[model samples]
Target: MPRSEYVASIRSRIGTDLLLLPGVTAVIRDEDRFLLARHQHSGLWSLIGGAVEPGEEPGEAVIREVFEETAANVRVRRIVGVYGGHPMMVTYPNGDQVGYVTTAYDCELLSPATPDLDELLEVGWFERDEIKTLPRRTWIDRVIDDVPRGSV
Candidate 1:
């Protein structure tokens, strides 16, 4: 997906300099397994989530992000965690650097769906052991418990 208009406006002014932004993510869990998306750009398996649009609540953002990214309908169960810094910082292929303060939700999948392909390569559920083997963002340990670090 392209940068949100809100973000584009910021980039127009700052021009790829570091920007701290609010983001949301969903840890869509079904018992021991979790729903994750494989990003087309990074080739990393990550939680289903995205930035909080202007005037949107974090909860609403997570729900919207889940559906947009994976075509999955989800309900926010509760906030799982809030994180920032190293792992949350992103430098896009275009060199637009963003540091995200991400609000993560414990979400329940109302219905599973396919990945958008534009944003993701695949979307599916994986067990704890399986996830550890997949390439993942650094924040995986902060999101899921008792897992060894993942590839990438």
Candidate 2:
């Protein structure tokens, strides 16, 4: 099936009007740098995360998503912030919408592993100074800014 059709199928299963539901993103840090992923769909870099499955807690979702997307095990250290998925609409390359409510977490990597290249085109650690240069939507900047310094 096409990507849009697949997303629609998933949304239909949720039984909600919102296109996207609750999800988690990990702001993983190793020393002063943060782990980031270059998304396969948008080609824009973002934190590793995905939707929280039905019946699963937000913390559980982040751990599962980090391993699935990046192949790196992580532990949620703190809740960085909860964000409206409305702003970060899951727009496919063709402009299809997949709605979501993202929960951004400050997490710590529990193991060293390479990211799954098929889902994430690039994965690496970026310093705070470099984070400013990454090609990200404005919501990312707002989320990161909300994280208190030295909290991670």
Candidate 3:
């Protein structure tokens, strides 16, 4: 997984110190299905999203991330929740640590797309019940549980 230039620069100065960065998570729902991606870094399925880039709004970050990982365009409908603390802490294989203050959004898919294989192993829509059977981390479970069914 390639770190964003912004994150790379910060890591250059701080090394492996935990950086509390702003991030976003997109919970894109299209009727009975929700979008998910199998992230390369974690090798676990998760909601579509990524870091909130410098100067970008949280909503903008969600849109950018969703497109980058899934090649899917989306409109942020409403915030599902804000999350942080222990569950948001991440330590990469290289030992770089991060604590993300993430804004999870309920989004509406607006265009056709599929998983961007460069960033993800796979991407697909899943029924709510089907999510429990997918490979994921504990935090991923909590994030999915935070989203409401049907619509945001």
For candidate 2, write residues 1-152 as lDDT tens digits.
12334456766675434465677888887655778888777788888888777678999989988888867787788898988845777666654466667889988888985868777788888876688898965566767777666535
Alpha-carbon local distance difference test for all models: 0.84, 0.75, 0.82
Residue 15 miss distance in model 1 (angstroms): 0.7
After superposition, the stretches of candidate 1 with alpha carbons farther than 4 Å from their true spots are 146-152
Residue 32 error, candidate 2, Å: 3.6
Per-residue lDDT over 1-152 for candidate 3, one digit per residue giving the tens place of the 0 to 100 score? 66989999999999999999898998777765777788777798888777888899999989988888777788888887898889789898899998988898988888876878777888888887898898875566677777666645
- Specify the highest-lDDT model's number: 1
TM-score of 2: 0.82
- Name every residue pair that clashes in candidate 3: none
TM of each candidate vs. truth: 0.92, 0.82, 0.90
Q: By how many angstroms RMSD does model 2 differ from the true structure?
A: 3.6
Model 1 agreement with the true structure over 82-146: per-residue lDDT tens digits: 88889898887888898999988888789867999899999888987788788889687687873
Alpha carbon lDDT at 121, candidate 1: 93
- Order of all candidates by TM-score, from best down to worst? 1, 3, 2
